[model samples]
Target: MRSYLIIGMCVIFLIQYFLKLQWLEYTVVTLSLLAFLGSTLKADKFPRWLGIIMMTAGLLIEWNKDTGIEGISEGIFLILPLLSLITLSPLLSIPLRLGGYFNSISVLLRNLLLHPKKLYAGISGTLFLLTPILNLGSVRIINEFLEELKLPSALSAKGYIVGFATAVMWSPYFASVSLVLLYLNIPYKDYIIYGIGFSLLSLVIGNVLFAIWEKRHPLTKEAGVKVPLEKQHQKQLVKLVFFVILLIGSCLVIEHITNWSMIVIVCLVSIIIPLIFGIVSKRWYELIPRLVDFRDRTVSMLNNEIMLFMSAGMLAFAMKGTAAANGVSDFLTTLAHQSVLLFAIAVMVIVLCITYIGIHQIAAVGALAMQLNAVELGISNISLALLLLLTWSISTALSPFSGLNLMVSRIAGVSGVQTGLRYNGLHLFIIAVIGIGVISVIG
Candidate 1:
């Protein structure tokens, strides 16, 4: 029953976004929150309670403010990322499993192991490159490899965080990009170009900082042998590489021609590419049943994301009609007037500070990027967006409370604080400065 309900929401969201149906979108958004609220009531421990608090605050604030039909309709689209991921997740898992991509990763790692001197750089670079293709799936693969080697968790956690965080900073398919595009209302292609440039800058700085850390605290024990990717996997690996590129290229072209959002475009291409691949390779018959079997668990995986995003939307809209909104806007405007460059730097620090206190970066970013009104920031919207994305990715990476941080810590077998902050804090700060510089240069 939960499986069906989850699947139902996924379908509604795709339909709602694709058709641009305001009424239906809000209907689905409302339903999704209610369903999640029901589940939260039953299981109050862990991060589940965070969503409940957000949802409750959203409700009370919205009740007083009354964001009518239109505001309600607009807020509904904020869940686009959740819905897009759901549609893409099952479709994506099929290729990672059946296509050579999964095994190809092991092959790549094996090669990295051969060049032991460059191993950290190689692993970090590989993760940054593969994250858009694999998302958290990359973490699973890395974790499996790390666990087999009996490497200490703390050693690899910072590298993993850097790799994955860079992916979120720039990828068109990442939720951060989707949210940025949603509010900025700009061509994703423009942001993609800027994002790529800044992301590279951040990576270069992060890797150098990481190398320094490695020098200061060398690995205590040897990383034992890893099995290399074999010939059979190599044959499929080429095919996997070709298709992943083709998939991304096709989505960009289709978006250009149709003027659809990246989320919508990705959802469409993710489904189409694999379907065609499965059929042409004569694997559709086998693949379809396995994908169907996996649906139950795959759909259930969205619990936290759906809850936070939907409630955040409501919270954002409700804030618009509150005095607190004006106060925040005024403060930001005054700060911006003082210095856009300094303001950008301050934004990064504030995001990290707030994250330390347990506020989700998404909540703060959505508020900053979406709700702040009438601030004479003297920064180009694109520059502002780059600043926001930089802070969002870096803060989330360093925040122990963030989903990404917790998952990485769990998989790497380190405490979240150790991995998320103790190890990566200064590295992330340097990256933040680089990110601001990149934005300033572009502006």
Candidate 2:
């Protein structure tokens, strides 16, 4: 059953991509709605009210656009549910775990954290020297400190989770930036250097500010928990290495094949690699039961309010397709005076606003890029990419609604809202300083 479902999804995706079945979008959407509704009705574990609300919200979005029966038939409705599925999938767990492992090197990490000042300086220095690697490494180190020191779990989680944003700040290697670079036919190395300079400044400034703030309002000290030294260490290590190789390799592969979107590549690797590794062992028949389990668990964990937001995305996308959203791009361009500073600030503001409204960073960044590209603004492609990267990194770092935040919160046994808010100021400061610096230099 699971294989069939996955195969079906793949087939549908292929049809959408290759056949350009604008009409099939309605069918996709209708099925997605049905699945959402059916899952909500049959599941007892998750927040049913939330599911109903999401379904209702999706319906409202469809109605507002006057998408009508044709929209439903065209598979527009499935967009939200499918997007939700991809966003909320276990596949993402691979990256999360990779991030977690790099963060768990206690002794080495503690040596750095002991001197916060030095650590911050080193990170800043390395930002330019090692832009491609610093963000991921910095987060891992911070996470190790948080976990080892037994700081308030919420604070610890925030520190580690926010690291993702830091990495995204100026890293040219980031998929989001890479995509924009590819589209514009810009040199990857030049943009990466630009990103590095901005990222380093942000990291240093952000961490310093955060450390000072914490010193003034010290969090309640948490009791140190025993580290799991022996039991799962080897297993964890193996998984971590595998994840790193996969992530790096995925990027390289995509760089070579610019025709395929990053998401498709990620999805393919996620499904295929695990099977090949026996991480998901075959008694191939067992796959169905696992998928059923997955669906059940996912449905049970449903927060229907998420659907309303997703519905908004569908509406936006649908409108964009039909030209209803063209005005939005025009409005954005008009607000800017073509001055690099003004355009940069405007892009940041727009991304921030969209993020605040519960939109995912990936979607927001992609949408903004497309709009910006359409206008043929004088903004340098590298600068635009940098701004988009900053927006995405900051938004993802600060949003409790993000999957990364939710997962971190769950793992640390803390509230997602609390985690998001705790790190919000720090992320903004980092992005502002670093983002501005990169834009200025590139522009």
Best by TM-score: 1
lDDT of 1 by residue, 118-224 (tens): 56675677677667766776777777765666554655786688888887777776777777667777677777777877677766776787667667767664555
Which segments of candidate 2 are over 4 A away from where they belong?
Answer: 1-7, 14-27, 39-89, 92-150, 167-246, 279-309, 319-328, 357-370, 399-427
- Top candidate (lDDT): 1
On residues 1-443, what C-alpha lDDT tens digit does candidate 2 reach at each position?
32233335444664565466766665555545554554455444333553354345545655667878765444343343334334233433333333345344443334445444444443333332322333333444444454545445634554455445555654443445544554455555455566556665665565666578667866653333444444355465566556554655665566466755444444455455435533444444544444455455533444342343344344334444335346657766665445667767777777777766665554466556545663366566766777777777677666676655665676567777766666556567555765676576656
lDDT of 2: 0.52
| Candidate 1 clashes between residue pairs 3 or more apart in a chain or in different chains | none
* lDDT of model number 1: 0.69
Provide the lDDT at 268 for model 2. 53
Give the range of the ten consecutive residues with the poorest summed lDDT in model 2. 126-135
